[model samples]
Target: MMFSSKKRQRGTLNREQKKRRLFLFTVILAIAILFGDYHSTIASSVGKETLTMITSPDYPPYEFYETKDGERKIVGFDIDIANYIKKELGFKLKIAQSDFNGLIPALQANRADFVMAGMTPTPQRRENVDFSIIYYEAQDTIVASKSSNLTKPEDLSGKIVGVQLGTIQEQNAKQIAEKVPNIKLKQLNKVPEIVQEIKAGRIDAAIVEDTVALGFVKANPDLQFNVIPSIENASGSAIAFPKGSQLVKPFNDVLQKMKNNGELERLSKKWFSANLTEEPLSTNSPPAASKGLNLDFRRIIPDIPFILKGIPLTLSFTLSSVFLGLFWGTALSFFKISGIKPLGWFANVYTSIFRGTPLLLQLSLVYFATPQLTGYDISAFQAGVFTFTLNSGAYMSETIRGGIQAVDKGQFEAAMSMGVSYPMMMWDIILPQALKNILPALVNETIGLLKDSSLVATIGVVEILRSAQIVGANKYIYFEPLLFAGLIYYVLVMGLSFAASALERKLRRSD
Candidate 1:
């Protein structure tokens, strides 16, 4: 009986040990899966190689976003071509988006392996980046309001014509303007913006690529496009790559293959021949000009949710930038105040550079240059935070220095008399008072950062302004969404101001 009982106890202990071992193994496996290097795994799973392609997504029949089931996806002819080439070359594809004007800069910065935005290779562009063989030929068309009857290039004489900035059509319009007398050119960032300008009577007509203008004209019943036949041998769309990129030859080879196999023809027919008029029309068509300022806030009511979604991103960006900028600004303030000559000189030069230059330029440089300089594919959010932190630090450092200097010398003398170390004295006795003194200035800076955060829209961070722009583009209406976005910004700034005031009042209680 004793031997049997001992056997039972041993068996129970073995089972318990097995259970513990299984639990421990499961946990370790989970940890490994969670912390494993994703980049390599993703690359291996997807393909042997990965390449980034950047494009401006606002152009349709070329590249644009479509929202379905509440998720936005980039689609169109260029995307189809890109996928085909990616499969042929056995490389995984990743896409990044930016404004049309920012695309070439993105290539120059090595932010993308190649660009496929239905771009035309121009002499000026060739000087900066290499290009693949022309895959598709396109022509410019004049888009105008139906009543205006400005169909031909000659009709645009003595009138203002709009063109999308940094596009082949813009160049075509420039050439036409040279020949046509009294023609004024207005450049916009996106085709939709140009279309909006036409409807608003801000411009008489716009020069748009035939395919792109078709999409807009079909959607806007009041608008029509007429092909410009005078400009023969019009620019053809080609892929762009960084200067001396190895991918150029391979890309050209695939493009040639697509042409030879009639694949290019198939894609063109699929995208170009299809009628885009089936897409839903905007509910907010403008009233007749006789009706004064016929505004429709109801048109953008559904899109309010989309615009509101940007608030969290805007807040997160602003707060993260402010916190990081404050930390960096504090460190820089110390460097400036430090008696060490090199540190002071370096800090002064740093402040001068950031303070002197435009924030938009700094944002662009940081977003584009980081990948080329460091090989880190920084996200839009990360690039925005880093740029804002760096730029704000310079301005804040000066503010902090002034605040620190304003502190009475007697406080330092008293602390030294008590044998307090310099570091502790600053940390405990000096910074608190200095920060209190600079609270209002800091509040002002924070407000400025919140508003300036809109600039990040250029690089495709969908903060408030970018969100509004996207909605404006998608709905093909401008004023309602933008004015709503402005209201949101005003409300947010006021809330921040009130909060800062309350905090200041509380801080005063300490006195």
Candidate 2:
């Protein structure tokens, strides 16, 4: 009886041990799978060459986002061509996005391996970047309100004609302006923005590529486009690459092959033949038909969720920048007041340099130059944070210096008399008082950072403003969405102000 009881106990213990081992094995397998998946998602595969392609996706039928079943996918003719080339060259392709004006700068900065945004190869552009063989030739069109009846370049005399900045169309408009009398030109950043100006009656007409204009015209029944007569040296789009890139020849070879195999024609027909004018006019109508600052906020109702999603990113960026800037600024303030000559001189020079230059220029330099200077491809968000931190630190250093100096010298002497070390005294006693004195200034700086956060949009950080821009581009209306974004900003700033004021009162209680 005793032996049987012992045998039973031994069997139970063995079963428990096996269960424990199985549990641990399962956990280990799960962790391994998660780590492997994350690594593969973020980094290129080993021994597989990956090329980064940059483009402006607002150009439909070339590259644009289509939301289906709560997922956004970039689809169009250019994407098809890129996929074909990637397969032919046996290289993995990753697409990066930026504003149209920033694409060339991105290539110069080595931020992309190639550009395929239906870009033209002009003489000025050839000086900076190499080009593949022309794949598509597009005609210029004069797009205007249907009632305007403005049909030709000659009709643009004394009229405010809108064109996208840094495009072949803008250059074409300039040439026309020189020959046509009193042709006032207004350059915007995107084709949709130019179209908006026409709808709002702020501009008489806009010059856009025909394929792009067709998409807009179909969506908006109130608009019409007239094809401009093709002149010598007409613009044609080709792939753009960094100067002397070896991939240019391979890309051109694949393009030639596609042409020979009828693949190019197949893709062109697939994208171009599809009617994009399916958007219901009643639902997506613009404010043009109404008089005197008309707005239909209902049009952006569906996109509200998309635009609101940017708030978290904007807030995170601002808070991160402010915290990092505060730390750096405090350090710089110490250096400025250290009584060490070299440290003081270095701090002074740094402050002067940052304060003298424009913030936008600094942002551009950091975002575009960091990759070339250090082989690390700094993302748009990182570049924005780093640049804002550095720039804010310079200004805050001066503020902090004043605050530290304004602290009663007797407090420091008293601490020293109590045998407190200088660093400890500053950290525990001096900084507390100095911070109180500069709290208002710091709040002002925070507010400024919040507003300046919009600048990151230029470098492709899709914060609040960029989200609004994307919605505007998709809907083909400017003022309504932009005004809505302004309302959001105003509300945010007000809320921040209220919170800061409450904190100020709470801090005053300690006094």
Per-residue accuracy of model 2 over 1-511 as CA lDDT, tens digit each: 9999999999999999999999999999999999777655533322237889998888887887653332345677999999998777667789888889999999999999899998889888999999999998878989887677688989989899999888898888988998899999899988887877777779999999887887778656678888888865477989999998888877898899999999997887787655433442422345245445456788888878767777888999999999999999999999999999999999999999999999999999999999999988999999999999999999999999999999999998999999999999999999998999999899899889998999998887878887777777776667776887788888888998999899889889978
- Give the per-residue Cα lDDT of candidate 2 at 418: 100
Best by TM-score: 2
How does each model score on TM-score? 0.82, 0.84
How many steric clashes between backbone atoms does each model show?
0, 0
Which residue pairs show collisions in model 1? none
> Using alpha carbons, what is the TM-score of model 1?
0.82
Q: How would you encode candidate 1's per-residue C-alpha lDDT over 378-444 as one tens digit per residue?
A: 8899999999999999999999999999999999999999999999999999999999999999999
